[model samples]
Target chain A: MPTTLIGLDGVPYGLITSYAEKGYLPNIASLIARGEIVQMESTIPDVSSTAWSSVITGANPGEHGVFGFFDIDRQTGRLCFPQFSDIHVSPFWEGKKAAAINIPQTYPARIENGLMVSGFVSPTVEKAVSPAGWLEKVRELDYRIDVDSSLAQESMEKFLDDLYAVLDSRMRLFRETRDAEKWDIYYFVFTGTDRINHFLFDAWDDESSEYHKPFVDYYRKVDECVGEILSTLKPEEKIYIHSDHGFCPLEKEFYVNRWLVEKGYLEFATDSPALITDMSPSSKAFSLDPGRIYINAKDRFPNGSVGTGDREKIKAEITEKIMRLESDSVCPVARVADGCEVFWGPVSSRGPDLVFLGRRGIDIKSLVAVDGLFGKRIFRGMHTQDDAFLIAGQKENLPSPFHVSRIASLVV
Target chain B: MEYLDYLENKSIYVIRESYARFKNMALLWSMGKDSTTLLHLCMKAFMGKIPFPVIHIDTGFKFPEMYEFRDRTARRLGLDLIVAENRLAKYRGMGPNKAGASKLECCNALKTESLQQIVAKLKIQSLLVGIRRDEHGIRAKERYFSARDESFKWNYTDQTAEPWDYYRSLERDGTHFRVHPILHMTEADIWRYISREKLEVIDLYFAKGGKRYRSIGCAPCCEPVESSASTIYEIILEIESSKTAERAGRAQDKEDAYTMQKLRSLGYM
Candidate 1:
């Protein structure tokens, strides 16, 4: 049977259940009644870049070797965004007749069997699609990879309108593609969910907020899209709906590198350090975005002091010390693990030495130029490891807990 | 890297990572072929010197040769050995023959509980377990870094994904992780590694009267399989051709199909 997999980035299980129960999402409610929604665990350093890779490959980071949204060069200690090419393993659709539309980290798309369209990071629609001829059709449909996220900071009305516009064009593209092509698997993703969550998560529960109604309407439209897609599928066809990760209302942004500085674990050569590569000779450790800490081992980094023998001692000391850190009488640092413990495989040595998971509502960052240990930025929502939901097409009693790594099995 | 080099590097990376992550961590040394291989990897990872204590959960029912090998290896490697035994349980004479007790109960009271007590006393945040997925069906479901609650209950129901080497080493209150460095290595890989590295193992693994223990545990529970493999080379050759399960000779595994799952869910390393 042909399979259809739908991805709604950053949609939480609780939100779907609650909204469906409240009659705000009748389509999703029918799926819930017909089958069931199970909470799925996302990848560590939970982000689209890592989680989507897992979903496509059906393999863990140790096997696929893509650790985060950004990876550090082992020799240079310079930061670089990891692309789909950086992924070590071929996706499940390697030899299948599949159409993967708008999946993140898949820029400069390639599909040997069927159609391919890259996601948000893709520069333009022209460059995002393979088989170059699809470009003209995509442009004709006004197909946009993502909503202009910066518009939220400028004007909420324009941002909301753009969100609806992009989602509308996405649905149109889905219809145009699905009806025109014959494939064994059709994978479509809505990145607008994550964008709306990042800027308007607080508006979701707060009825008094101006954007609350618009937020609910955005999801209501998604439900309509899902219903429409289901209507086109044959009775014997399979369907699976899931998200990369869940979302939570952001409380405070924890600047991890600043905290490291306060604890004397990191030192910057300049008072206004711009990046991790600017660390001074005395610097023992440094962190990248989303709380990935790497030790500046003398054997590895150019300006380093901590030797290979001292990595364990230093990591343990940091783990203990980081647990004691408290902000507003609450511990934001949830868990800390050494690099090898979190990652393995050939390229794992290029990964961070320690992975720090923040508690819910606390967004962690590793920007070296932050002024304080904690602060609020433009984001009103944060990514969470738990609470992502999956509604399997041919539901059965799964032998193990659901995770993004196993999501590929649902369709491919 | 070569296949053996790959396995060695992965194991060394895990060993180093766990040591760095958990300051109060220790390696579980069962004096078995797998754990002894793990011990060698630990020394290699830490630059010819093991930085942490190596624990041996003594059930007091081990073979004499196993004990001899343990002491000899510990002294030779200069390892900080901790012989963790439930002296109270041993003193109370708990064994398979205990009244109304099944082999499972004896194992829980002795092996599992002994490991639990040592972990609690030492406040170990992480424990290096030498388990391979190829060894059991349930172990095949385990993560490289698996977590257990304060009461030492393995939450096999809700394991997080480990994609591209990023393991879910989330720190929760009163939760400890079981780091499995060799989980990906197969039985054949282990023997091949042993042969290549020339690592020493207990003599029991070699054929004794055309019989050898494929997997070792407590003396009463473990049995030898019919094999004429007298050296590491022969063992490697045997592993390539042998279709028998590795734990077939262990009575504990034969108790029931789900017995290991049940034991593991209750934190049996």
Candidate 2:
């Protein structure tokens, strides 16, 4: 019997019953019927890089080194992605020959002795690995492909037309490749469902109050795609459908950074303007990036230095300040264990001496005189701290929903 | 075929969804692992072909190697690359060195403005990004299909509810949408996928002189972390035990409390 695994990005298990009942996903429902589907608990941070890493490596965030999408360099204070070369562990696929295609958040198409296709949102051809030899031959036989969006709306349609033509050709290429390649493993990814959900969510509702249509159309299309793939698959293959996490609506927006500044945990230079001209300034400063913050300890103190003793004091002070701020309802803050929940801590060398979590409905705002800092209004449609789903083959032998860490064990 | 098969399937699903739904779309490629992986997914969705153009907003301060890798990859992948720049800021000789502006403002000038101009010029109706909800507090609240108005404002309060896979697109007023294909994924899954697929990612991720890129961004703004794990296996071990955030090396995020949130609200990628 042949084995096939299908991974669905961001397919929340919570809504599967409803979607399946509505006939929006018969293929998925049938697969679930044949197999057991369970909610898989995600990592503490629940971020993609971290979660995906855990899923593939069967490890936690502490083991993957991918805490978030952007991390500060300790020495240079620059932000960057943890590259493949930076990885310190071996993934299960290291020795296995497999055809890997477009896994979001893992770039450069790193499959050996098998085909590799990149994902969406990557930079143009000028920024990706070139297809060589057999891949190039495949490209030639495929339709003309050009992935470029013009700067003008008038030319936008042309871009889409070109895109569609390429897509059609590539679909053909996929069929050809799959049929010709007699391999033990094959992998593929798609982002259309996510795109539609983000853009047209508001179009479906008669209430005209919330974003709606994009998700509906996207899933409908996904269902169709699934149907097509199912028709092409053999009975012996095992299909696994899953998502990274779940989704929710945004109720409110809170500017946590501004709240932090107001609460006094963070301080800035009074002598000079809050903004600095040089990349590396000599003045005191405080800034926020999502849930984390950074303080210029060297420039803030009179002596311009933060000693080890001072580090403890600063940590205590910052923690107390953040806790107080959380109590005051200025922002949503939570204390999480090191590898258990989302908490504030060092991200890299230049990370904020302290970190905080902005509650689900809250959006952090800074009082700094930046272009978008002030006068920013509230937003709707938010994310939630929920465990996503992982459906492996038939539901009979799946792991518990809460124990997502065990997903690798199932496959291995 | 075990874990790698699962990772590949999920990514392909996201790529196809993005292609079929949004009429006008583009991608944000920072030349980093996550975004680059997203790019690779696009090709896979189309079966070894990418249908959409890829955008790279050059802030002129990226590491020299990043640019080299960018060019080489573009040539190799046969990508339609669109380079967006903040011409006005560049003309004014603006950079991270401007003292009056906070790191947040610097990002606005270099990244936000460049992205806005590119969107306007391209008339992009939707943008496919590689952001994950687990990355940050504010990001944790984001939807798979996030909407943005004409001025690129993100109204988190009035967002539509996505009950399960039934997402609501077509905003009443927004000109574009921000799509997150990997919102539900965790940090560990990404690493696992990379390892399982043997994906070719940027070399900077590995430790250099006992340091590695915990997260990547601009040259002057991003930083690395201390680690002895130079190989992928060792790095995984370090991550499993560390307590640091991913952006610890980034300087701009430390300028204010809500720096990233503010920048994101203004359409900063």
Candidate 3:
């Protein structure tokens, strides 16, 4: 008997009920009939990097140190991602010999011994080592490599055609690898579904939209791939499928950061030419170091200088002003935290003097700085902080949160 | 079954379901941990065979290593690779430095526009991506099999009901469904699976010169964070208890509030 694990990017259990009931996903329905389904509690913020890090490390965000999608460096006042090199904990893969394919957002592109495939949004060769062995195989199969975004329209079509071919090719390669090599574990990932959702979520309706037929057709195509994999599976092999979290519809847009700026918690330079061109009375600055404000003291003040005495007074005044606006519903300004604790580094290098968190139901829009935070049209959908779903092939022998740390323990 | 077991099981089931459902689907490869891990899962689901094409959208501004890694991994995995780029934008000299367009515009031209064109050209209905709700406040509202309009706009107010273990795949008219296979697992579960499976991963994750790529992106936009942890184990430990965001190194994100949301709304992946 063989053990196989298939992970999805964002397949929520709740969303699958319709497909199963309607027989859209018969294989999955059959799996459910034979197995137990469970809900997995996700970490706070539930961001991909942090959640995935936790999954690999079997630790919490507090333990993994991957808090959000972005973080401010306490020392240099720079924003950064939590890289594997920056992590101090051990992942189960470190002890086992396995092949990993298509992991997103990971850098350096170096793995222990097994084969490796990077994901989208990753850095290029200058930023990380090239897995030439993998590249050669793909190229031999006539895979396309896009070096620039110059011929976007033409390139996109080419990309799509190539994507379909690659999926088939990769599946064939997997079968070959399984037959040619004797390995304990092997893994690969697919991201077409998530991409479709991000761009075509609105196209899956009954309306006479140009993307309607194409979206439906794509789903059917993906279904065929699922069937193909099932057909090739050994009878005794255990198959497990899952996702990081579910999707939701978006609606209203809010500029929480802009609200903070209006409240005077965050101060900007008025004299600098760049600042003059960029900053509007309604514009807001976004900082990962919540509650910390970076004040250009030298250029912001009327006398071409901001004295320490004046800076302290301004900081104090801003804190008070923000506190007063915390409960205002129209404005998304939540309570402002103390900068001294929220921001790190010397007073000069740290972020804003004040940090703000939006109240529930408020999501700051990215256009706040350029378009002025207020008065933007509302979006139809939004995200939620819900627990993700997990289903196991063998109910009794599945992994648990408490035993998460033991995943590597068992594999190694 | 334990939470981890349940997560793994669900992910595998979703992957298989996706393979079974879509006839002409492709996996979007960003060369990131999540998507890379997703590729691994596809192999596992098929017992070493990835049954779909791998698509990479080249914005022409990605870090050089990303291209190298993409080429290397695709070849090694024997994957059918498709590289998409917005030639119009590139030829027009569209880049991060453009003044009027802002970062969101830049992404639209390079990423969103390119993706839209690719999907239309390939007539791709199902696209597999590695998006996690926890990654962004707006992402939390997404559905596993989400519906999209022809123009690719996401309608949050009117969403279909999603019960347990069932999804809505067949769309009336010409609409399409977005499938997410790993919507249940968390960052911890992914790492645990990677470790347990001893999956091979990228090396930029490790620190260099007391600085590590907290997140890897374009050379001009992506920056490193100061860290002393040199090994994966050490990196994992640091991740378990950090208060930073993963995309801190990406400059576009800091351009303003809701920058990501705006880009996403405009169809930027």
Identify the leading candidate in terms of TM-score. Answer: 1
lDDT of 2 by residue, B1-269 (tens): 24445456655775666567777788899988778777877777787767788999999999888899899989998999999999899888778887677788889998998999999888787898988755885675566788888888887645543432445566444479888877755566677667765767778889989888878888888888887877777777677546345435354234223333322332222
Better of 1 and 3 by lDDT: 1
Clashes of each: 11, 199, 270
Task: Please report the TM-score between candidate 1 and the true structure.
Answer: 0.61
lDDT tens digits, residues B1-269, model 1? 35579889888888888877777889999989899889889988988999889999998899998999999888999999999998898899999788988899899989989999999899888999999977875675577899998888886646654544666676687889999999878888898888888888888889989899999988999989999999888887788655334324453233322322321221111
* Docking quality level of the chain pair in candidate 3: incorrect
The 10-residue segment with the lowest total lDDT in model 2 chain A: A338-347
* Two-way TM-score contest, 1 vs 3, winner: 1
What is the per-residue lDDT of model 1 for residues A216-285, given as tens digits with 9 covering 90 to 100? 9999999999899878887877888889998999888888888889989898889899766677879888
Model 1: docking quality category:
incorrect
Off by over 4 Å in 1: A124-126, A302-304, A399-401, B1-4, B7-269
Better of 2 and 3 by lDDT: 2
